[model samples]
Target: MKANQPMVKVISSGKYAPSTLITNEDLERLVDTSDEWIVTRTGIKTRHRAVDETTSDMAYKAAMEAINRVNYDKDKIDLIIMATITGDQMTPATANFVQAKLGLNHEVMSFDINAACTGFVYALETAASLLQTGRFRAALVIGGEQLTKIVDYTDRNTCVLFGDGAGAMILEPSTHERNQAFFFNAARGDTNNTLTVVNHIKMDGKRVYLFAIDAMEQAIRKVLESSGLAIEDIDVIIPHQANERIIQSVSKSMGIPMDKFMLNLSEYGNTSAASIPITIAEYYDQNEVKNKKILLVAFGGGFTWGSAILQL
Candidate 1:
């Protein structure tokens, strides 16, 4: 290697969950739902519960796991980006606490990003821009959502769709000719003041289904068009785990097969911003993504949607 190469490459990725494994059947006890009902509609079988774990603890655990996977000096970590709709506090940004908890006290800059379920993709876009500008060599981007905190367990329509967990990734620029410099984009719909109920996530399942399919199709097209790659060129698609129907519909509309898209929503449900990173991590564990062109598309509550095309 030379004196100083541009930061490139995902050093490692990590994920963590609570001790409790709450299955859809367990949800039947708490709400008017059945395992079959959930499985048929959303393809969710179970999700992790925090079990007294705070968002801070979960975020730190995921960060440590990512750091452990790589040998980079902690001092070189210049940025920490955290994506969460449910930050530990409504005042202090969760990234500050993460930076402090991880002993990242080199006067590094950090902040929280919120695009509801699209948070991780948004944060990753930010981290990638920092990399391109040479403003930061190594960045820690985490998507940790304690969605159970905000979920209305009494509402069967929404409650069964969420879980608690954290997923992390280490990113650095690259000079090597690998799967790099693909497509990156984000688009948003106007925030629905009428649809919102005083700062809470207002989700109408049917409405979201329509929105997810539409927004996802647009984002996917942008990634393909911006990168000048055909839809057939992508090897795997790591889309946000909003629901099974949405994933399938998008795949079909794009003229792609279902097997080309990764599935982890059945296990983790929807962890808001954590969905994308967690899905990617699960795919990594399976060793299905290597030297492959991947398209990551996401849509979330903010009505925010994004996509990133990578070859890795």
Candidate 2:
């Protein structure tokens, strides 16, 4: 007894960052840890630090990139949904600030979704659903995080695992694409225990590792069933870049080669919610996502996880 159109897809994507580099070497200065140790544990060599850059700055940078890539007029966008927990302030949604800084006209709706690390994928699903109704012509899905602000640099366990940056995707209605075919779902494991400060990027590395593989494995299967497609039919997997080991395990268990997946976690650590979007932006910069069956799977705070499958 359901009636509707079909699925949605991403047309163009962009990413941006500050020039400041916060390397593992720098971490040694603020915390009791060495670059070698950090890399050995997290596969992260360096991460960007806004330093003096605000969250709006990163969001703006990303938004401009997507605008250029999509060749979209700011006045033409239908909605702007930023996937982030690190909004620049408590008031106006970071999406609005980003919208203003990007000089986007008010023809679109703008807001933020805070699913921590799962932000980008969740934002995509949200914006896609909005477009499925035929009301939205274009959507700006962005993910930006300034984790360096809340990070206790002295806390080795947490400080070593985050970076700063932003990513944006221009989602437009694909005339040939069917919204009824897109599949999306999110599952929660156990992070309800820390939902209070859910927007603050809380994490237990070991616990996340254990839950990530299992949760991602589950999320992947759910979308596969929903989309009526097989994993082998998917061209590339864009996973939340939280850790090398976790990504590796999921790829292995799914029988998907490492090359079939994207990896930027080695350099960014866990950029909290910004991981997936930033990775997608970087990958597309290299012209990787063309004419492919795309899969986005992510897991994060709230112990939540989900997957999205679309043809691009």
Residue 49, model 2: lDDT of: 84
Specify the poorest-scoring 10-residue window by lDDT in model 1: 192-201
Q: Residue 225 of model 2: what lDDT?
A: 76
Candidate 2 accuracy as TM-score = 0.91
| TM-scores of all predicted structures | 0.91, 0.91
How well is each residue in 93-137 modelled by candidate 1, as lDDT tens digits? 888888888887786778899887778888887887788786787
In model 2, where is the ten-residue run with the lowest total lDDT? 191-200
C-alpha lDDT (0 to 100) for residue 308 of candidate 1: 81
Clashing pairs in 1: 7-172, 7-173, 7-174, 8-172, 8-173, 8-174, 291-312
The alpha-carbon deviation from the true structure for residue 168 of candidate 1, after best TM-score superposition, in angstroms, is: 1.0
For model 2, how does the per-residue alpha-carbon lDDT over 1-312 read when each residue is reduced to its tens digit? 123435666677788777787888888998899988987777888888887888888988888887888676766687999888788887799989988887766576889888878888788878877887788888888889998787777778878888898888887765564434354557564634543243344556667788889988988898887766787888888888877888888888988799988888777767766777787887777765667777888887776788887666
Go through the candidates in order and give each one's C-alpha lDDT.
0.80, 0.78
lDDT of 1 at 72: 57
Which stretches of candidate 1 lie above 4 Å from their native place? 1-7, 176-179, 189-201
Pairs with backbone N, CA or C atoms under 3 Å apart (clashes), candidate 2? 6-178, 6-179, 6-180, 7-178, 7-179, 7-180, 116-273, 117-273
